[model samples]
Target: MSKKETPLFPLRKGLHTRQAHVDLPPGTFEEEHARQGFYGRTTHLYRLHPVTDWTRIEGPLRPHCYDLNPLKPSAEEAIRLSMFGSTEAGFAPICLLHNSDVALHWVAPDTMDFFYRNADGDDVYYIHAGAGKLETTFGALTYATGDYLVIPRGTTYRFLPESGDQRYLLIESFSEVTIPDRNQLGPNAIFDPAMVDTPELEPYDATPREWAVHIKREHQITKVFYPFNPLDVVGWKGDLTVWRINVKDIRPIVSARYHLPPSAHSTFIANNFVICSFLPRPFEEEEGAMRVPFFHSNIDYDEVLFYSAGHFFSRDGIGAGMMTWHPQGIHHGPHPKAIPLSRTKDRTDEVAVMVDTARPLQATPAAELMENLNYWASWK
Candidate 1:
């Protein structure tokens, strides 16, 4: 018989309730200090006040917020913003945060004269706004807002945006991005695999000409020219083809008597990171269950949330197309003003994407340029 690596044993020795996230001690807040990003061994500590109730934090670890709306790719690209998708200028995507395992980039919709193939990693493009058509090796996928388009590595593809205002948050994972195991929740709990839409075998018919495919490998682009369009896969069948799923189709898990952890909302997972979606849903209905996110320390992974739409209940001064980077070694939770409203509000209309990475992420220069200063002070 094989032995379990981590035994399931709980030794309770504290002034605690029978269940977590419900019926906390009066006038006390709950702070979960856990291991393995709320997956492994855990201890829920009941505190007198909020863990993030800080007056000041002076260091590099302060949380940050970056705006994608009206923010140009760079200073030089700002001048070319109007000229994007034109014959004169078409810029590249601005990298937001990156580490060894995965990186996030903000795609500024522009004309792509050539196809792109990432030999470095697979790309998961979250359509934040606008509509477009992706011509890939598998087929053509018509993408709109709230769609997640996952293109496998080494697949040649290019964008054909209907308008210039397309906004996308691209997650480049060095490892293969796979559907999270459903465990006991079953396969059809959050979403059904049958609902996942794959591209049709509609190849584009264009004039025969030299086409350039920019292959990115090891942070360098190697242009390869072909006499015809590279997305000419007549008919192919494989599990490793480009696929997409919209946020509307995802059904979040919620309980009236219990508040689920962020891991419960996980949509996709890589080796060292996971992507979750927060959709418009009703708050926990039970009296003792907390409707808002509880205070938790980022003990293992760094948390990055990209706000998409709706009124963000736990956050203030945040709008769509903005992202918050709450680094590790910090305690963060609901904002001061948002807490009072959580009592009255019964539902959350917000749509956001959250990525938790095992290692810390480093922001790119473009992210720094677009950051909304003094984000950490918002907690006060």
Candidate 2:
């Protein structure tokens, strides 16, 4: 519940089902109105048509979809910077969605020569492609695709790509990034925290040379120079180290009788935002149960989804390495074509990362340049 609770009241005013996302009235659609990211009081509005049935959504409030493939560091850019080991113009992480709580960026970095320290917030990087090793204050850890690597704020680190291939969906949270404590589901609901791969202290062998540590605060960069290698820590001990969990290790909670809400898939919680993993899972199998996502306005939070792989059941014309943003005040759910398509399906192979921000996210000019303007028409 939020600071102000909606009095413990339950009332049904319309011709609706007793349970949400279950058997629906004929020729009717469902829209979920939730509070506090679906944990608080909610209402399932049974309607004749989905709220997304709009002819034209003008103004800046319309939904956005960005194809991030073009933004990846190209071979030309990598070859140019391979000698100097500097961040190329196109090699930098492009800020796509951001606000006070969290900022999401797309990065395909080359083997970096400089170490980075985020003085602004904690970083959670979703490995979308390639493999690499990250040397941090704690130690070094090898990273592969589909990994969620959480580096605490102020941790000095540099990502050393194995080759020229490296792409990541990086999220910088303005507050502490912690695991969601599943009160009733127990601590080991989706995954055990102990299962997370942590870095082991290893001597980072490097010749004596001047190293630059780039610190970012308020989105401004400041370089701090050191005579010797900054990652020359011999020993360390702490729980607050760079750790990661891969999507393959995630065991999604599923139900065949009822379709679970997004909150049921909560993976990580932060200040004013939450991160979720939408991995492969079985769909609702009970007859008459809604097989697709119900239409809904987040009401308070802005929604962002990064498609990692597999076919996203609720949408169409979207593939891996793509992103979609649905700000508050709009009702978006499954595309019209998706409802019938899902009825013949039993399980989904989709893998995605979802971020719900309490504050709205502004698309950067870099992200706007990669926008698919016809995304709004896909719902038709």
Model 1 TM-score, 2 decimals: 0.92
Reference-based lDDT, residue 14, model 2: 67
**For residues 1-380, could you state the per-residue lDDT of candidate 1 as single tens digits?**
98768855566666776688899888888888888897987888888888787888787887889988977554255343322111213436667788899988877666577888889899999999878888888888898999999999888888888865777898999999998888898878898998798888784856699998877887666789999887777888767889999999999998877888999899999989999999989998888888888888878989999999999999999999899998889988888787679889889999999999999999876678888888877887
The whole-model C-alpha lDDT of candidate 2 against the native structure comes to 0.84
Cα RMSD (Å) per model? Answer: 3.5, 4.1
lDDT of each: 0.84, 0.84
The true-versus-predicted C-alpha distance at residue 322 of model 1, in Å, is: 0.9
Return the TM-score for each candidate structure: 0.92, 0.93
Instruction: Score residue 307 of candidate 1 by CA lDDT.
Output: 96
User: Per-residue CA lDDT of candidate 2, range 95-163, in tens?
Assistant: 777888898877787777778888889989999998888889888899999999999999998888877
Compute the lDDT of residue 210 as modeled in candidate 2.
Answer: 87
Model 2 residue 206 CA deviation (Å) reads 2.8
The reply for model 2, stretches above 4 Å from the true place, is 1-8, 73-91
